[model samples]
Target: MTNAIQKLYPSTKMSIVLAVILFTLMMPGYISQYSVFPIFIIIAFISGVGTKFLSAFIKSIFVLVLFIFVFQCFLIPSDTVIWSKGILTLYKEGLEASLLMTSKIIAISSSLIWFFLVTPIKDMMFALEKAGFSKKFTFVIYSTIQLIPQMKKLSQTILEAQKSRGIETEGSLMIRLKAFLPMLGPLVLSSIQQTEEKVLALEARAFSATVRKSSYYQMSKKPVDYLVISVIFIGFMIFVWWRFFK
Candidate 1:
């Protein structure tokens, strides 16, 4: 099956993303924990991002979530003890607190991941530019987005070079830890050098010159874009009402 969500206009998708963020922020922790995740899980499954979501969750958010869970379980005291061993005690209250935080983080991160996974950077830049956003600000965001992959590739190259030089990256934990320092210096120096070069290039191109800019690509909003935007607005309003008036 095709991923229909990926086919939506960038503006429409961005509106939906903003709405999700607003909704997550407005709702209480308990409600967000109970509500936000299941909704996104379904959307992710339908959009064929379930595998990506799982991979992202594992690699990025999982560590933070685990840390919160462990921290709360140990430090927070409650009357209701779910588990206890010698010096360790797990409380129902701490579990609830951890779940609340985990859900909020997951909701926000998942929305952002969904946005980047489906929308091309050019399309995003085009949409923002059309919406009268600042070119300089957008350039920073766009540059950072492009820079991430370059840095990742650079790191991998540095690692391979070290391995080739008989730097034991594998073995005991201490050996790997010792290998890390050598990897760090080259990576940091190379990044700083590249950044300086980019700054010079941008200056040469008059990136800071105050003039209206034009995009080579054009983006036209479809009827579905309006419809999706309307739905998102209504959802935001409903959330506001429920959060404040209800």
Candidate 2:
């Protein structure tokens, strides 16, 4: 995202608008689960091209989808049996429910993560502002984008530290639950430490006191920006009409 994006999007606003359009298109009704495959292929290319941690990024998506599927298996209330071979008779409705939930979860997550990778946070926030979104809401979006990576790293660090400290995660479920508390302790502490560092850095840089700070890379809209915006707007209107009236 840092090094790869070089005016591929005419401006920050365009990239964000494109991202939102992709997000809407990936939904279940706007596009079916089967058709989402093509969108994901494009997403894979975009994320691969934009993000630096290609392996981890790709792996995270698989993990995310798998987790959603497994969670669905437990949470979905279905009566249809899955299998009738040997001693196994799985519920068909459960399987359908799991697949449906998994499709939605995976598509939504992939679309969002791909967008974050391909579009810079600054560009996204500015785009939201240009699109008439309130600054307060946009600020939340910006801060969340900035903090998620830090929180992910801190989570991994905590998990690894618990593993190294012999937390007995391989034991019974009860023991694992007990171990979770201690692991959460370190995660909390590290998160607090990171927040403090962010505060100090903000203060040192006079982050909010002075106004009219200049950006090093200004994003002036190009002809492509208008084209992309128009397409997205037209597409959105079509979708809304189809959803509400058709």
Candidate 3:
């Protein structure tokens, strides 16, 4: 039951993500800050992406989030000091600013991970195509998303080769810097070569020809998908009214 519900329509998933982002952006302070987590947890559990979403979110944004908090605490000067020690001081307003920024970042990041976890690349492309996006544009978008992992793998391969050659990376900063020089060369070259090959392959398949591309993939929305989408839409409206008109 859970697994089935998790497999929602790509459009439905996209709607929820956009709605959450919109709400987070419009509502300031604690409302936006606190609302995201509960919403994310609920979506994650229902969609069976709890572990994956959490792991990805933390790994990707943990450093940035920490930096924001620390930077704001020390750098942003305020009259009302929350904590003080000689030259160091933490301001109340600065801390509040840090918390708000961190919350927005986390909410946006988690929502993105949730979208990718639940929607396959092919399905996303198909959905975009159905929504009147050009096939070539969708292909480019998909390839760009895929490029990150490919580059990571390439970097790992380069590091392994360096390790085999006795280039110490886990030693002093200078040694690691030396190792990075060799790794950087091959990684960039290989990425460029891969891009060229992909371009050639696409050209060979008449990708640039003025012809309609036939898609084998199809996506359909169920009643649940509709219900979820409608709810998200209503939520967005209510948020706007409360934030502005009301």
Candidate 4:
């Protein structure tokens, strides 16, 4: 059974995420942008996917944000030097820019990550189809979203198979690198084979037939969805006024 938040319409969840992205873009200062990150964590916990959400965030976006911060601090040129040690120098301007950029990245990425974590991909595609999206468009969206998780799963399976075969996958960095290199060949070939199989399966199912498709699953927006969307809109407008007019 899904929780209340997870049970909400995909469109509703998408709108909430879009609002977060918009706010991150429009809001000034590091504090506001960084504030959105924790809000996503709170939402993830409320939705009962906090552990998965944090694991994914740490493995992906956290590393990317950290890299951007480090690169900007060291590489970007500026007259105002904040810190220096030996050949390394940190610029005040670069640090400020990095904070702003990384904060936006975190807010935007976390919102999206939270949405996908809470909402299943199949349900999202179904909702898009209900919202008048073409099947082809929805299929592309579904495929793109599923690609990463699918690849990750496949890689893990292959790694385990290698380990079972007495391959040295868990050792020094060089040993792991060697193990990983062999896995790449199999991974790529397996991915291609899976794609062909999927294509054949789609054809067998008349996926491209010029006929209408019907689904048994029905989804509709509830009153609470409207209430939540309204709250988000009101919050957005208030932020806009405060950001620009005030």
CA lDDT, every prediction?
0.82, 0.61, 0.83, 0.88
TM-score of each: 0.75, 0.55, 0.80, 0.78
Worst 10 residues of 3 by lDDT: 1-10
The clash tally of candidate 4 reads: 0
For candidate 2, give the lDDT of residue 110. Answer: 51
Q: In model 4, where do residues sit more than 4 Å from their true spots?
A: 140-209
> Residue by residue across 15-36, what tens digits does model 4's lDDT show?
9988988888877788988988
Models sorted by lDDT, best on top: 4, 3, 1, 2
lDDT per residue as tens, model 3, 1-246: 247655678889888879878877878786656668767878787888888878887889889989998889888897899889998899888899988888888888888888888888887888888888898799889988988897888789888988999989898888888888898998888778887898999899899988777787666889999898888888788888989999
Per-residue accuracy of model 1 over 94-193 as CA lDDT, tens digit each: 9988887777787888887777777778888888888899998789899899888988998899999999999999999999999999998988987888
Listed per candidate, the RMSD to the true structure in angstroms reads: 3.8, 6.6, 3.2, 3.9
Cα lDDT of model 2 by residue, 150-243, tens digit: 7888778888888898877777899989988898887788777887888888779866664544445456667766776777678766867776
